[model samples]
Target chain A: MSPGSVGTVATQHLDLPGSLPLDCGRSLRRVRVAYETYGTLSPARDNVILVCHALSGDAHAAGLSPDPPPEGTRDGFAAAASPKGIGWWDGMIGPGKAFDTDRFFVVSTNLLGGCRGTTGPSSTDPDTGRPYGSAFPVITVADMVRCERAFLAELRIDRLAAVAGGSLGGMQALEWATSYPDQVNNIVVIASTHALQPQGVAWNAIARESIMRDPAWQGGDYYGTGRAPDAGMGVARMVGHITYLSAPSLAEKFGRRLQSGGDLRYTLHEPEFEVESYLRHQASSFVRRFDANTYLHLSRALTYFQLDLPAAAETIMARTLLIAFSSDWLYPPSASEEIFDALRKSGKEAEFHLIDAPYGHDCFLLEEARQTPIVRDFLTEGRA
Target chain B: MSPGSVGTVATQHLDLPGSLPLDCGRSLRRVRVAYETYGTLSPARDNVILVCHALSGDAHAAGLSPDPPPEGTRDGFAAAASPKGIGWWDGMIGPGKAFDTDRFFVVSTNLLGGCRGTTGPSSTDPDTGRPYGSAFPVITVADMVRCERAFLAELRIDRLAAVAGGSLGGMQALEWATSYPDQVNNIVVIASTHALQPQGVAWNAIARESIMRDPAWQGGDYYGTGRAPDAGMGVARMVGHITYLSAPSLAEKFGRRLQSGGDLRYTLHEPEFEVESYLRHQASSFVRRFDANTYLHLSRALTYFQLDLPAAAETIMARTLLIAFSSDWLYPPSASEEIFDALRKSGKEAEFHLIDAPYGHDCFLLEEARQTPIVRDFLTEGRA
Candidate 1:
């Protein structure tokens, strides 16, 4: 076993009884949540930390697969996972890491509308016994928090030591602290905005349009049609990927640089620029795992979410830490500053840090070296 | 006729003898140019100003409909034109406007790949007597300049008083001064870049993808099919429209303010934001007038174009005036500065002006109050 490897981890599903009422006045008769836990819960249950995943993230937060796959066996996320089977944010959640599994219990779950083993559009409808598809009720970030809170209740963890995430995950964390003020003591929001900007919403709208406009989308009921709108979904991914990157980053990586053996001449259907090739690859790889309907539902949730920090500041009990990247135009530092200003105006304790990371919004995921220390310092000391 | 209107504007087609050679080693025998001339050509022929139009623009510069519509009478561009037969640059090319058609004869032509009565993909193939369609030879900005040069020779015009345009038109202006240094005396390039940015190219690539991926496109031969890929073309325009406006402009103009009677809840295929509605309008109106293949060709030309000022500096005889908008992210001031710097390094006379216009790249066409004075002052004087 490699050093620092999370030896074994297991993801468990919790099927909660009773209807999960949503903000849209709709309710699911039964809700299923797939989650994973690391470290032992303290006797007092005071060391439990909840980690929220981003838009397309799953429950597996840290640690290796419980059973090593046999030679040549590859399937699901297991194949995508590292040799350690560690989850997203594994760098900050393991033993001696920021979240410090050895010192604090860490829990992660697939978001409510996510396709990864969660109760989403892909989940079987209790009444129809078929995938919900376009029939799936829309969910908000607050609803996702409520769902996650239910999972926490099932585990008998009354209060969270800390709630942390980035981007959409950060939105979820903010919602958790805002909705259940007493349940979370600390909050870390990175590269996120209190409310999605109109420009951001514009991009999301176009992405959704790309998918829904596809004939193969079949009005989001392509599950039984034997064909999916992979091309549309791919284009959406490509567009989204461009937003995730800064111009400077793209220029530095591929400034008019052509693909291998590529020329500067006009050729239809040919990717002359390296960036085009890169975006094409990103699009093709994304359609393999993501669900189109789930994307639609989650993207709608993002735009629909209205996070008024001034209103939430009065009720927010968590000591907040907001981190934003300098080059993240999608969710610029001004967004975090807005939340921080509101917290200050409300007489709440908060800290805001703008990292000079030119990697754009995805910096939270890619610049782990810079993000880990900042996150660790915030998580450990309550506020930086 | 309305006073100050460019009355009796006629679009004249000229067939130049001999073949027009292209950069790609292909030549079109007997090239046709659709152009509009305002004012009488001086006896010396030195009072002529060749006006270039941007992508999707046509041989229309200024003056509203020469004759007022009889209440509901509608015809071609005359229907779309303002009451005075005003052209796209109505603000800048009027009797007392910046270009001052009363003093200088102004000529504007539909670009090489344009569908507006010019020889393009929609034009008949002289050899086959059918629409060129996808078989149209790809054209570059330099090729566009060469075609315009042919038009000038056909008019027996030996020297131009000035050549001016904005955006893609600006690219053509630069190409003109570079290719035919002795033919043009002054050049005005506004809201343009010496070289296209990868990010901008990325957006163009997606827009083209949106059109090409449409099943209705039928490999660019959808003409006369009664069902062109309007949806895809519209989407492309929507994407392009977003790039043409600044985020702050969108925020100030539309914000997250939903369309009238719009809900905050999830609804499919609905434009919730006013900005989305605006984009839809822009896209729909564009698909009505613009051809899909022309968009592909022009967008490809933009990406493929590489303007090396050093190479053309020695031969560039036209004293140049470069203008950039303050909020034009698509082609910011830095791009203009690059050309200015190159001209300075090459010991050429040039002036660069950064205008404080927050309307983004389209500011050149929209913010003429600010642009008019700068352009007028430049054209009136020799050089800054």
Candidate 2:
């Protein structure tokens, strides 16, 4: 394995004896969850910060161990490098950023429906010894949060200093605060909402449909087969990539400029404009590290997210800070306002800020001077 | 034989003989254009108002003859009923509306590469007698305008009282002034721009990809194959429909409401929210009337549109009105400013108005009260 790559972590399975009734007509039995952790736990075990990844993200959040595993032996759990890997969150995390690694013990785990060393559709069914694929039970954001809590208990972490994330990660952060209020002290929800809007669900449904419609999908059981649903997955990624950007950002990066040819071929098959090529690149990169079934699962989970439970808000233990962007269409500024209103109505300690950024929904991932002070002040307040 | 369908118009074919050199290195030839017309041509042939339609709209601008054609007739050019039929443009193009049908002899024609009465990818290729499908040559907005000019000449109309349209129709109106400066008198371009922005192209590309990736697409030759690419086309429409509405509209229409059931299903395959169902409805309606190949062709044409021909601006017909909406994201207010600036710089008669409407990009199609006065004043000015 490459340096800084986290090899396949050991899977510890647990069978929760009772059955939990789901919103769907089905019930889950003997629920088993798999997870991973990073950094050393403090004596008090109260400095934990749970990092939840987005739909395609995994448990590998930060640095790798010094002893590396053999190459190809850590395919699933190995933390894949981003185009600018650790640098993707350089301004927000590290030794000196808001999520300072030197002070807090960060624990980033693979989501329940994820394929990165987690019990997802790609996992082998213990009974049939084949990939679960279509047979795997569908999951929700609440279920994923439950799995994270289970992983923390297994690691002996009793409480969390804060739970924070953006996009789907932000959704998980909100869930953490509501489902297990006593376990979290502070909550930072960035570029997210209480639930998915129709536009958001509509986009997700199309992406899911694209993957399932691919012939190579083989009803989601394509594992062990030489061919994968690359085409469908690529199309789905293209859709997601579009949502991740603000309109202004796309125009700045790839205007009506033609590709290297300097001229457009009036043919439907060929990509005439530079924007088409740019989207194709984003799609191809995603297919390399993601599983089709996992994408479908996670997208659905996001669509079903809801924090309207009276009980969840009534038992809140953490003070919340909601951050939103002006140009984010996917999770617009209005979404942040709704969450802030909910917290206020519940008589909870909550603060909201709408950051002026033209980078759209993904502004949280970009570097802006305005965000630094806001985040710094929030994280450093009343710290022991 | 549907009573109100726009497919009943008799089509007149014109073989365009001009070989215009394009910026795209490729030269187009043997351009066969199919079109339709409405209203009687005055003896002077000067009282003409050109009507343009949106992306999926056809030339059957208005009116349906009470006399029906005999059954089993294979004639494809009879004027068909509009989707909205008589009520669609009730506020704009009735007897005494802004487009006063009694005074002006209105003309509307199906665009080139359109599946309606016009020659498009679905039309039998003269060279092969087979549907062009994926093999159809890509077209540009300028090419579409070129075909429109031919349709106008065949009707013996030398000049138009005003050229008006919304969205893609608005694009054609602007192109008319730039491509054939002297032929147009008054130009009313609403909720449109000189070129497709990066965000617009990105959305269009995703929509096209969704259709192409569908297995039923059959490389664009799904016609007569029983299985159409409805899933992919529906997904494409859903993406477009989102861009047409404002964030405020979406929140108000489908907040966090659950679909019929109050419970949240933990499954990935089911839609636990009401918003997903709403999008599905929108997507399904679009697929029923649109052809996948035509959608792909027209979307690409919209992306390639650019009417800022500096040299042509000096010679453009005077008297132009540019209208934009504050909430329109697809064609933001800034785009309208660009057009207004160009016309003013060229010392032409031009006026720009930014209407404050919360309907997003579809404001022009929805707000008739605001659009009526603006259009009426522009067209009535300096009229005979």
Candidate 3:
């Protein structure tokens, strides 16, 4: 029930005719892209903006979903309060929100290595007649952009008014701009970087280790097995849940308040602190909806993302809108500043808007109101 | 060798004559403590400076340990470069170093609920003649201080010239000052806090969850099971290790360097990034040395530490020295500032020094040279 939420929508999938080449030097024979669209394509198809999803996100970026996927799509804290059945970015893509579906068509897609109806590790390999699981080729952000481009080509959309997303999705948008500079008119990257900082790399590494170490993971071939690496994935989610939030935000949400009413329960196995309990809840919920191998693939790909934005400076015709959150230690404002500085140095038209927000990297998804004017004005003014 | 090294020390054990009371409303019988001493006791016994160790450290503080613990004592990433046979803080506690063993008899002990030859979850329970394991009562920082007080009492020492430590050890130091306010004359709390911040709480919680979720942990009673929760504990260590260092330090140390030259190995099962490889090595080494049950107990104990320093203002006679590193996001200078503000507001003697270092929480162990002068000046100035 957001002010301008796009009405109920369903994800649709399309298969690429040719094999999609991956950075791993392996090509996927049957590549499928699951997508959802808000707004309408103009007669010339010049108003279409390609939207990408983050590490755990999917095609349903805005509007209400007709059906909840087997695993819930709601991740992050405050998820319980987020309008149920609504898209992840429901607040930012509608008649009058940030993306402004009224004037421009916004299309979101599940990334190349996603599990949500996207041909990923969980998908059956046509050659082996088994889930790809361990057989899925390692993909890169560039490869994801390639898949998105091919998916759009099937729709007969050769050029885009813009490409946009946050976190991993933002990486995809950057890939689109850098790889197909002449095709994308503008790029909106939020709470992302040209490269993940080292600590961020370490966090992702630990998360992947957690999943792989689980005996249930069974060498990434656990799909046929009834059991999943839920415990390990839960721990991974907990780590990610904390990273997506700033310390101050956690402090405000759950301080050292004990789960028990007053005194310490004096139990080692049970959750004591309110934060501990919250983390457990977050972890459990995350493990249920996400695929472990898909997580490993996506995490590895994002970790490997190192954009040479400067090298593509000459060919890039896109007017870039780079938005970063001040409290996003995972993707700090310094990275956005680096991007902006590089773009300006190359004499490219760009606007960098750093939102002074406290929610950490989650700010990109949560701070919809603040981002509206900036994104709207940027896109509209670029046209003007 | 460290300058003025208190060379070739051995950990010694002593059993308390009576049962020690615990915060869990239970008492531990036949409680034993392992300790190492540097310098010599004065005729008046007033020259004793009790130095506590951090979460993973033991009684070995300023010298070359004559006998290496079975699993080895080195835990940091720079363990290879760190001098062999030396204590974790060998550089910081010698005759002319921070503790200045030349003037003061420095006493170091394996903390209560520690795995290092102390009466902890890994130790034998007098009643069952078996390892306490999950049966061990949860202990707190105050309980650790109480045990320290009892251990010192057994040695016929009624008061301490100073009590000092970093991280978890610093928590115990603050606990000592507040619990036995009249017994401790001065306290040096470095890169530690009165209470763990919410984010820190989350990290520790995730770590504990990592261990508990491992099937081999067997509800924390896996001591004799032949199968240890090495995988889970390794993941826990990886998480803890990353948190202990700054992002920039990792960037400087590892960057985006690949383990195999410059190409992606295109494998998910193996470590590709140098940081990932380093983490695996660190985790395996840590899992081999550390006890998972003891980790659970100690992690739980530290999480429960929420010292209300201002509440004990009237009884506190100790002059406090608070040292915080600039890059220590884990502990942070803001926490030290809070402690300083509380003491200052209570009209207590306190000095707050913020060192501009980049090692993060590990600064307490790595930036020994920078800390020595501040600690020595603080201790000596108090004596003067």
Candidate 4:
């Protein structure tokens, strides 16, 4: 179906209690979760598939609702505005695509520490009745998976057909399989690793620092002021954009061509090259949609993701597929190798494929040619 | 020579007019050249070896004077500090080193449009009596070589020995032989190219744009205001530093390691990885010593460099040795192949060697084991 064809489903707020004790020796109470669903659930609810998002992703995943509200009708907290966009992953979730909306019902949710309809730094602190800001409890990947389980319970889904995602979403998929092996039958982890390598965490650290240093951040409590840390967020996006592309991809695309006009401006303010303008546009676009605090929170959660698999072989019940990109420096093929090795050692039916693409870590989002058949065969043929 | 062996030697500055008109359609006038000499000039003065610096190098090419002044004492209207106390190329030049001090009278100068003791954007505008700033004329690589010729004239030295350098310095060395064939006898173009391809230019453009976009740049007129564009310059340096190193180097040095003591802050302000901190330090050090405008000027000059040899393949006069590093993405071995092919096609005696080093573009600066013998043999043995 085309955009805006699906009907909107009202979601109930979920309160999930924190799992781990906080650093302050206290446990967080009443964690709230927000989510959206597509297609119809079967009588067994075993046909449910969960889609997780990356660092800046929100809950509105795939299939636009019919009679959607006009653009900007609900301010920043409402659904994303573009007609073609309910979520960033809409392309993979529709009829006969990867997620196959026709057969299996799909669910996507905003993470615990997210800005969109979830309990985050932007959410009100029940004790203070104001935004949590810096006071929002720091969280881990297990905590996020706990909230996802809560969302699943709210929908009365006892078991999921599969859980799949890329990047941070991929991390969540792995977390689901490991934390609740019986809950998930099929797991597809794309371009993600068991833990954040120092390099990955380093990049996120810089992005976070860029936001926190912005005067507009106001210690993460700038929601009412309307002066978000746009500049800092822009810088973060620029850095993130660089990491998303391989060196060869950058060389092929922008390779130092001057601006449209002939001569160099010989000044600093003017655009000297086209790539600079492209990066500037990317930075600007990111700042408009993403909350700086949420960016920080989600990035940290992704970094903290570590799966505690069964020590003995044959313990993991879920059949696994690990996909990586050859040029994805962020989560290279080596990471996939680690997962594949772990699954093999555990006597689980596992497969690994490294798509040869020059797009770097972003290949998962764009390499449809390489991904389609591999994912389709693995999901359809493997036991679930 | 421990940095203070050189005694008194007369120095001079000469002006060379640009051959082509700038973007403003104004031809540069009296393009001032600053240079220094070490060791006594032979009776014939044919023993002079011209030394060139990389993108941000200056005229202090050799030993410091016996009586050195305080830092910034001789600011000399350039964006970088005076090279009066220590020379950047001191490591390879001296008593019995590669370019032996007693045998060859070395001549090193600040390049045209350079900030260190040379006529660049920070130089006084003849009409306005203020720094040229954004009004400074755009310069070409050929123009820079011509200006070097003027400096040679002032020194009463007609080159007979050799010209050598790494990176941009190597580019100048190549230009010297092509632009003034009769004025040179031997040439060593190390880790450089005739023209910067799109990949190299892409990195340069990003770095240049970063400096220009910094608010402190003030349209390239931040001189005397003590408000240089440190942010932009820092970004520029960060980009350049990446090019100077290979992926393997980064992986080995900073791979995913957290900062010394702290855990991930879950905010955007702290460096999560050691590599990020390393990059920050590199950027900061560069901005402290180099000018933003000079970076733009030199990068543009590199982009425009082309060897103009008349006659299809038989007109190359100067004996040339082309050296490149396998891992140097900035000036890849492919570019050096083009240079070697052109020279060989002309039936010229040319030698090319691709040194295998993993340090990337900066390999030329650090690979002493590979460099010493090659450079020493090429310079000392031969056709004179």
Candidate 5:
């Protein structure tokens, strides 16, 4: 693989052959998976690595767009995929980076319930010929994994060199290992949990409530309306952003520092603290890009995550590496400990590491210096 | 002193004679303070103990209503002062409890910017004959203490036996000792800080934002409309409630427990977890009783709290007792440490205790067994 081959990337769609059986005992048909890929498939097709995204992530995982992104990228992409096409994991996936495109084929797909190019709430319904919106079926972590597995089938990849992600992406990594233990040889999970803690669940619930309570939400049927539930979505994003950064990080960055041009006194209106101004900016920008119904679906899926599959424990074969951040209150050290303990109990080889970082849940995304070497070593040294 | 004397509690109002100057350099005239007293004042007024209420607290500190509370109790009171007039500190302010009404005359007053029968945003402006609303002057911890000082002067009490409170009330107690060093003999502050931390300020800012964003807020002048910004206030209360309780406590009480009627799987429209239901109830009840404008004012005051008073180091003559809960992230142990270190550096006799409790910031309010003895011992054994 060369840098030139990875530089020009576009989202590609595949119509999955069969209906996906959901965790809710329902089935989804006419499933279209949108994905992006880099590197090349080895002759044996064993160099494939699947990259799953967390909540609000998309298929645009890497590459710089010399040209504009694929046509459907903007219509539903929840994350900030640059028009220049820089991916979320752009730092970790070049010729010599962690994934090391020279030796590994990388596949990144938007989650099933995402608003991106993949079929989700913002996608048109085959039966009604309209966006799914409120009519979209609720999706679980298992359902998302099933769609990705189908995508793997479409690519004719029999086994994976590794499956990796952070946060909700990490959740999918765990699910991939458990759902099909024989297919994955290595799994890297970062700053994530098997199931949502009560506090995490509460935050998700409140975020959803903030959206639902918006008059413009219109019971998740705001797609046809000119106005989306941007206020509710903005509040949700603000709340989520707070959890993404550590308290110490906020204190160090903003402190009680008043916003520039604002008086250091109390007021009934106006942003006072720098943190408030920052949060406002984060919320406003998020509402303009993300789909509210997709947010609702994905957030709900997070609450339903359960890694206690008895059958998976018995058959699990993946060599696992679990990483937790010191300040990630959303997915704390204890959450990773639970997964580590469960894997060891099941007679699997699992390694756990806690990184000391102030970025909180976002440490996995930002601390590339610390992460790249560890990930490269794990991916390279473990395989036959 | 007798239990019978304490049982016949009465709420008293005093119209302050002079214009009350604010920390913001504004003067508030026609100031009226509503307070409730238990037990009789000593002959020398030396046994008078002043109790300062927290953000949502009122003059009704402890008492059972024979029939029901006064008419205005519900209209303005910030906290859950039952119609039967049960005090906020019911467990620790009785005949033989911490404050021991039998031994000390106890006085609790609503803060200046509070809605609870105090001249606040809900109170009428003498000039316009309408609610002050946004016109109500931004207040500080010092202003609240000043109003309490006036109450003390009206009662002809030269010195206090003690001044005590928790949370925002704790801020007031610190203010009482520092602002008028000669008037307060002892100060007991619990689950509070010398100043608000950046995270605390952020939370308060978000809560206030939640309320201010409500369309019904109407620039803080909804008095004639007969409609309050309940949705915004409810969201604010929900956010506040999350900070008040610890993650461990929430996990222990409602760990992934689903609401009884909800299904086990993901749903976009319903409250799934028990914690979500619980928070919703908390928010709904809070908005019904709390005044939105007052929430804004009080929350802002919390951000402005500062114990860096130049005179406090030299003039704070009160014997101090500072209690911090280990799980209180809002006002953590470090917060109390700041206050304790300040008091000790000032050459004051101060005792500090960090109680290990899972109740978070509300530990001071809920852990009566732990706090009652510490407070009683400090008040009874410290005076020379």
Candidate 6:
């Protein structure tokens, strides 16, 4: 293993002891969570920072995975996929990294509605002994947080030094603080929002529509049908990829450069621009690795992540550290400012930092070195 | 009928006398154009203003269509669809409007590769007596302008007082100014760019992918299959709808408002936000009237609109007027500034007006009143 890295790790699974209640009022039995841990758990189990994964993320948040999936978790131009087995957030979680595995035990779990080794729409229904498919109940960020809490209970880790994440993962961090206020000491919400802006909501809606519209989706029952909504899900991934990036970044990287030499090829069904080819690559890569039904559910969950934080603001125990990037239109810094304002209004400890960055929402993952000092300072304050 | 209104107009068709050559080194024969004309032709034959339409637009640019199609040729929330038969740009092309039909003979035509009563992909291929479909030649903005020039020749109209349009339409205007500089007096290009930026290219690519991925598209040969790529086209339209409007406009209009009740319903398939429903409505309504292949071709032409302006700068005669909106990200004001800079560099007469509006690229259509005086002044100078 590389210096300061958590080395190669294996994912572990746990079945919750009871039914996992969903926001849709349905209870999902046989709920299982896939997780990975870095560093040793202290005797008191207090030096814990539960790391949450965002949309299209898995439990492998840091270090090297002994066995990487055939499709590999990383999307092109998003992370440090130096080698295929490197974790999605390997830059930020290590012995001397932002999470500082030397001082804290870090736990990362796939969200409830995820397709990555978790009980999701792809999982079997206890009653029918078939994939839940369309029968899977809708979930919300709170339910995801609830599943994380239940998973932690099995590990005998009742409280956490921090609950942290970015994008949807950040939403989960915010949910963790509010849902289990007494259990978490600090919450780091990066490049996320209390509720998506209307335009953001519209993009997510378009993505879900793209997936569900595919005839091969078969109303979310394509499992074992020898067909999948890869086409539709490919479109969904393309849309998401564009939204996660800033205009300037695209300009700097691809600009108006053609994929081929000089002359224009007047074809309707082919990619012409470098950016067009990049998006197609991303779409094809994503459709192979991700499940369409899970995309629909998780995208819906993130859009439904409107927090009733004011209601739970009073008894919240966690101190909030909100970090947002200027170019993150998906989850603008204004949302973080709103959170900080509300927390201050409730006399809760909070800090909101707007990083003037150009990487857009992906900055939370790509701008790791710049974020490390700020995150380490915040974590140190918590220890004080 | 109504004050300052043209009252009513009918679209007329004309067949080109010969084969029209394309930029791709191919030729389209037996080409037809659908057009509408208002006001009188001057004795001197210099009072003609050739108006062009953007993607999804047609020859019916003003007045009322006596016989509207079943789909009504209207997308909800786009234009003044107050009375159904109203032309898409009726507000800006009437008796005392910006185009001032009382003074100038305003001519509007469905573009070359259009589905609206013009020769396009849906047009019959003489070789097989079947719709062009996959056999349709790929077209560019220059090709559309070439077709327009041919269509005008059939009318014995040699010179244009001005050529004007917005977005993709604006690209056509720029093409005419350079391609036939000696034949045109002035040009009005609104919310357009000499070359589409990489981000814009990415969005267009995504929309195209959405349509092509639909099974019903059948590789653009779904004409007689009793089905269309409506599902994919719907998703494409949804994407276009969002991109055409600004985020602040969407936030102000919808503002995280729920679709049904005050609380969340927790449904995966159904839309939760008002913006989501609005997009669906826009998508569904669009697919009903617009041809998917036409959309694909037009979108491609617009993306491939990168101009070698510097090469064509010398020996160009038209005075240029470019207008852009502050919030128009799809065709941002920066593009207008670029055009102005390029024109000035070439010692050409050019004027650029950046209107500080919040409607985004749709501003060129919606901000008719604000654009009137500016357009009027520019036209008045041409006649002076």
TM per candidate comes to 0.93, 0.87, 0.98, 0.83, 0.92, 0.98
Clashing pairs in 3: none
Select the stronger candidate by DockQ from 1 and 3. Answer: 3
- What is the per-residue lDDT of model 3 for residues A198-276, given as tens digits with 9 covering 90 to 100? 8898999999999999999988889868989999999999998899999999999888888997988998778888888
Model 1: residue B360 alpha-carbon error in angstroms: 1.4
How large an RMSD does model 3 have? Answer: 1.5
Interface RMSD of each: 1.3, 2.1, 0.7, 4.1, 1.4, 0.7
Candidate number that wins on DockQ, 1 or 2: 2
Give residue B268's lDDT in candidate 6 (0 to 100).
72
Quick one: best DockQ, which candidate? 6
User: What lDDT does candidate 3 reach at residue B321?
Assistant: 96
lDDT of 1 by residue, B1-384 (tens): 455557566567888789899887898876788888888888888889999988867786665444422331112222344443456776687676788878889999888878877788888888988888778887889888888888888899878899899999898888888878887899999999878899888888888888888888888888778878777787777777777877777777777888856566457667777766766666666777788999998998877777766776677889999999999988889999988888888898899999887778878877778887878888889631
lDDT top scorer = 6
Question: Which segments of candidate 5 are over 4 A away from where they belong?
Answer: A1-8, A66-85, A260-263, A309-312, B1-10, B66-85, B261-265, B309-311
User: What docking grade does candidate 1 earn?
Assistant: medium
**Per-prediction RMSD in angstroms?**
3.9, 5.4, 1.5, 5.7, 3.9, 1.4
lDDT of 3 at A275: 88
Residue-wise C-alpha lDDT for candidate 4, range A1-384, written one tens digit per residue: 464234344434666655434432445566678777878898877788898877777777665544343321112112234453445565567666677777778888888788778778888887788888878767777677777887687678879889888888888888788778888899888999876665565566556655665567788888788788776677767777777777678767776666866656654454566666777667666666667888887876776565544452235568888999998887878877887887888778889998888888877776755787787788788654
Off by over 4 Å in 1: A1-10, A63-86, A260-262, B1-10, B65-85, B260-263
DockQ of each: 0.55, 0.57, 0.89, 0.26, 0.60, 0.92
lDDT of all predictions: 0.80, 0.72, 0.88, 0.70, 0.80, 0.89
lDDT of 5 by residue, A108-224 (tens): 999897877888888888889988888889889889998999889989987888999999999898888888888899999999988888989988888888888877888878887
In the order shown, the chain A TM-scores of the predictions are 0.93, 0.85, 0.97, 0.88, 0.92, 0.98
Q: Which stretches of candidate 2 lie over 4 Å from their true place?
A: A1-38, A64-91, A225-227, A309-313, A344-347, A368-373, B1-36, B64-91, B224-227, B265-271, B309-312
lDDT by residue for model 6 over A1-384, one digit each (tens)?
789899998888889988988787888899989999999899888899999998988999988888887666667666334678788888899999999999999999988988988899999999999999999888899999999999998999999999999999999988888778888999999999988888999999999999999999999999999999999999999999999989999999888888786777888877888899999889888888899999999999898887765765676679999999999988999989988888988999998889999989889988888899989999998751
Regions of candidate 6 where Cα sits further than 4 Å from its true position:
A79-81, A309-312, B79-81
